[model samples]
Target: MSSSSSSSFIIRIFIICGTIFNLSHQIKTIDALQPMKSSSLFIVFGRPGSGKTTVANKAFESLSLDNNKNNKHQQCIELDLDVCISQEMKDNFGRGIYPSLKERNVFASGACDYVEKQLDEKLLKCQQQKQQQKDFNLSAIISFSFVNTDLRDIFRERFPKAEWILIDTTEEECTKRINEREGHFYKGDTPDKKKKEEEVDTTTNEEKDMSDWEFNPVTFPHIILDGNDPIEDNANNVVKEILGKNEEI
Candidate 1:
């Protein structure tokens, strides 16, 4: 080959190699600038007496066991809104204070505020560790009766990426469960009366209580489990989903 042609071929190869190197470096730099996500928050919610507490407790236990088995640095934590609210009432009013049904929402709002503060602190610590290039992973499972869009929005705004699980049950089943409940104050609004209709069915008090409680398809999508299912089965399903999400991190 002529010297002129050989020189042109060598110059083309050099240009191609240099372009590839520059692109690779740019990709690496972009990746390094992105922060690592080391935290996961899971919200378990449903109507009152939907068996959310039982399933959430069992799921938390399973996740804790899995974390221990894997020797993961990630901490698994469970937060029950009812328990927190009860503690707050006891601390303020006294141990004998019957959780007032009328004041429940007020107390619940306060409890949510407390949890939000605690979460903010935990996230701040995670961020500090992240800046140092150290891992500080956390997994929190929260149980609550997020009966309305407003209540659910509190967490949705805080943790946009949070995963949600819903325990779904019929209104009749929920009333039956509430009737049998011994400790909780929220007995169904009309525990004794059963409403029926001859032609057009009207909304009952149970329906009214659950009027605003709905799963938003767009704003709040969730993994749903049957409330009638055995606790063990529901718990296993939750744990499976949680593990699957964690794997993505």
Candidate 2:
């Protein structure tokens, strides 16, 4: 072969070897930087229109700060069952009956169950996959209504390792806020209508004075924040609590 042709062949071989070596090195670097375990799960529970989404967003922001500051690439997932249920209801029942649909109220029960089950399955799969890879970091944040202790217990049983945060807001305040918020499932005169419906005597089947659902304390391991308080302050307090920092205004 000619000298110039031989030199060109050698250069081509060197380029191919260099490319393979660089690719292998990159794969090792990525594997080393990946998280080593599943991320933590956070469940934020509150009544309808009690600023659950607002608080969850704020909490995620604060957690992101911690993750960034620590140089940890942890994953955070916020799943709100209300939005899911509302969208499902709208799809099935249309907008009109959505106001008075007893089925919609029961839908929350079923949707929450479905979501919790799905989350459990996904978490298990993630853990198994990570076990193979020898590195996995995954977590979840679920926000839903905590009107019933049974429901909260079900969540605990489903995700035994999850961190629970319950936002306790008075029924009166929730109703008022719901009324003020437009385009919400519980917005407008629907709040007053719900109050009236709750007052109807089940046995007598007679409409009585207006009443709202009572705010019951959730029985779970949780950090409770008063929803009636300022949103920003309450959210900051939640961040502090989660990070084991001193609670400040």
Best by lDDT: 1
Q: Candidate 1 — worst ten consecutive residues by lDDT sum? A: 190-199
In candidate 2, position 121 carries an lDDT of 62
For model 1, how does the per-residue alpha-carbon lDDT over 35-111 read when each residue is reduced to its tens digit?
A: 44456888888888899989989999888887768645565678887766565554433222234334455655676
Candidate 2 lDDT over residue span 1-249, tens digit each: 999999999999999999999999999866654434344666777877788889888777876677658623244456777665656655432222232224434655676566666555655554445432323344566777655544556556656776777677877887688767766554424444456457745733221111223345765567778888887887787666555421210
Model 1 score (lDDT): 0.69
RMSD of 1: 11.9
In model 2, pairs of residues that clash are 37-136, 37-137, 38-138, 39-138
Full-model lDDT, candidate 2: 0.60
Instruction: List the global CA lDDT of all models.
Output: 0.69, 0.60
What is the TM-score (0 to 1) of candidate 1? 0.61
**Clashing residue pair totals per candidate (backbone < 3 A):** 0, 4
Candidate 2: lDDT of 76? Answer: 48
Candidate 1 pairs with clashing backbones: none
